[model samples]
Target chain A: MSFINYASREINLKIVYYGPGLCGKTTNLQYIYQRTAPEAKGKMISLATETERTLFFDFLPLSLGEIKGFKTRFHLYTVPGQVFYDASRKLILKGVDGVVFVADSQADRLDANVESLENLRDNLEEYGYQLEKLPYVIQYNKRDLPNVTPVEELSRLLNPGKVPEFSACAPKGEGVFDTLKAVAKLMLISLKKNEK
Target chain B: MLGSQSSLVLFDEEFSNITSILEKLLVEANAKALFLVDKDGQLISSTGETDQMDTTSLASLTAGNIAATGGLAKLLGEKEFSVLFHEGEKDNLHLSLVASRVILVVIFDQRSSLGLVRLRVRKWNEELEKIFNSLEKKAKEKGAGNQSFFAEITDEDIDNLFR
Candidate 1:
């Protein structure tokens, strides 16, 4: 849920990066952390296993400067994408304002991407939210890798809803900011439309 | 207001009441710090010795911790695990759910005991719940009457942030 602190003149929104395991959810966050200016970002916290897979979540707090005298603070989180981490994933979805589904753009991982997207929809339903109504976007990640699925195919499968989508090689930072900006803009627009 | 897209608005009067309660809890419990964070991990307000602390991370992690434990509660057929305590070599954490909407986090150490902290919290939780309940009710009653502060923002204002 978005938090509006009138006393502090701050607006806080939660956005979750979600997809199947190794789809570059954490990598997306790491890249954002690396590129963000020191004053604009807070410490990124990753609750990961010893092997570096996300165990619970990865959190990065960012200041998106000020909009109309209110400091717009966005807390970016990544859910553990492993199959058995479904419960943890559901927990992270609570009060989320937007979502980024980072799909691995490889031929073989198509099933994982589909399953994860289905899982995302189901989990969202449990929270009384429909993915269709939420501020959501998809990132076709790992576009630089050989054997990557065609962007058209990825879009045909994932973007049936036709939300803003991007193709990115997260480690190289391609489309990273573009993806972030798209979803953040969608969120602001949604807030405008929903607010009284 | 409990919907996913809904917002929790903290106006000045409610904010002052919350901060005063936090400050009172700080001295009454002799705690190092007190943080009133929404279940979503947004830090509503904090008091006491937090200058050296990374409260942003703390708030996020604490909410995550509570969430994980809450998941555990479901498996065992419970409503929720409303209270959690973590003991460290020096400082101990006392986290409890307040009004099911916010988390009350108490960071204490050798200067305080769990029994005392819990006692004070039990009393204050009632007061906190009243404030939050009224806040939620007010938000609902205000409904469409509340205007969007961002109504004046334009596309240029958004695009400029990226530039």
Candidate 2:
């Protein structure tokens, strides 16, 4: 849920980055953290395992350019990508302002991507949110990998709804902010529509 | 808006001092919003406009989120977690445990850099530890002196359990 603090002239929104294991969701965040301006971010907190599996979520707070004189603040979060972490995933999605479904665009990981997508929809439903109506997007990630699947095929299988998709190689920093901008804009749109 | 209830000092000197210090850090960092919540997930105070943020739910859920994640980490035979982060397209949230009693939340924009944030948190957290200890000492004194203050918090505390 986005909080509009008229007293402070600011709005705070929560966004969750989600995907299957090893799909570059964490990498996507690390890259953004590295590239953001010195004044626009806070500590990048990651709850990960010894082997690097996301335990809880990775958090990074950022400020988008202000809109209408109100500083637009975005609180970014990522769910554990492993399948057994479903309960934790649902918990993190609570009151989420937006979602970026980071699909691992690899032949072997197609099932993982689809399963994660389905889980996203189910979790959203449980939270009384319509997947089609929420502020959401898809990023076919790890595009630079040698065995990556075609973007069209990845979108067909994962993003059948076709909500603002991007082809990204998170490690090399390609298309990361583009995806961020698209989702931020969509989240703002959702907030505006909610106002009316 | 809160009335008929005995005023309780949730932050005490520790909470207030930390809050003021945190506010400066957030502003210097150009963060959008920030807050300090206790281990039980009760919101103590907030800097930055949280009218839309719902620090209430965030506090409860964040404590839950931290607890659940800590539990998972233990199950997997790992150590306890002191920090949590979430990165999305346009926003990010950082949850850092302060002196194991309070959790600090920092929300900022993509326009700011993460390296700077990490640097400041590392410094601010140390100061917070000392201040929290000082508040702890104050609480002990409060308990020894008035006693009613402690009793009041006890009543409120037990009242909260039933609630």
The candidate maximizing lDDT is 1
| Per-residue lDDT of candidate 1, residues A1-196 (tens digit) | 8998889999999999999999999999999999999999999999999999999999999998988888999999999999999999999999999999999999999999999999999999898999999999999999999999999999999889999899999999999999999999888888877874
- Worst lDDT run of 10 residues, candidate 1 chain A, spans A187-196
Clashes of each: 1, 32
Summarize candidate 2's per-residue lDDT along B13-132 as a digit string, tens digits.
455566689898887767778887655444556888687875655765576667676667767887668888888778788888887766788887876667767777777888977876
Weakest 10 consecutive residues of candidate 1 chain B by summed lDDT: B1-10
lDDT of 1 at A155: 96
Q: Compared with the true structure, what per-residue lDDT tens digits does model 2 show for residues A1-196? A: 5544433555677788989988999999999999998788766778899998898788777876565556667778888999898878777776677899999988899999988889999988876777788789999988877888888888788877879999998988998988887788777666554443
> Candidate 2, chain A: TM-score?
0.97
lDDT of 1 at B126: 98
Cα lDDT listed for each candidate: 0.92, 0.73
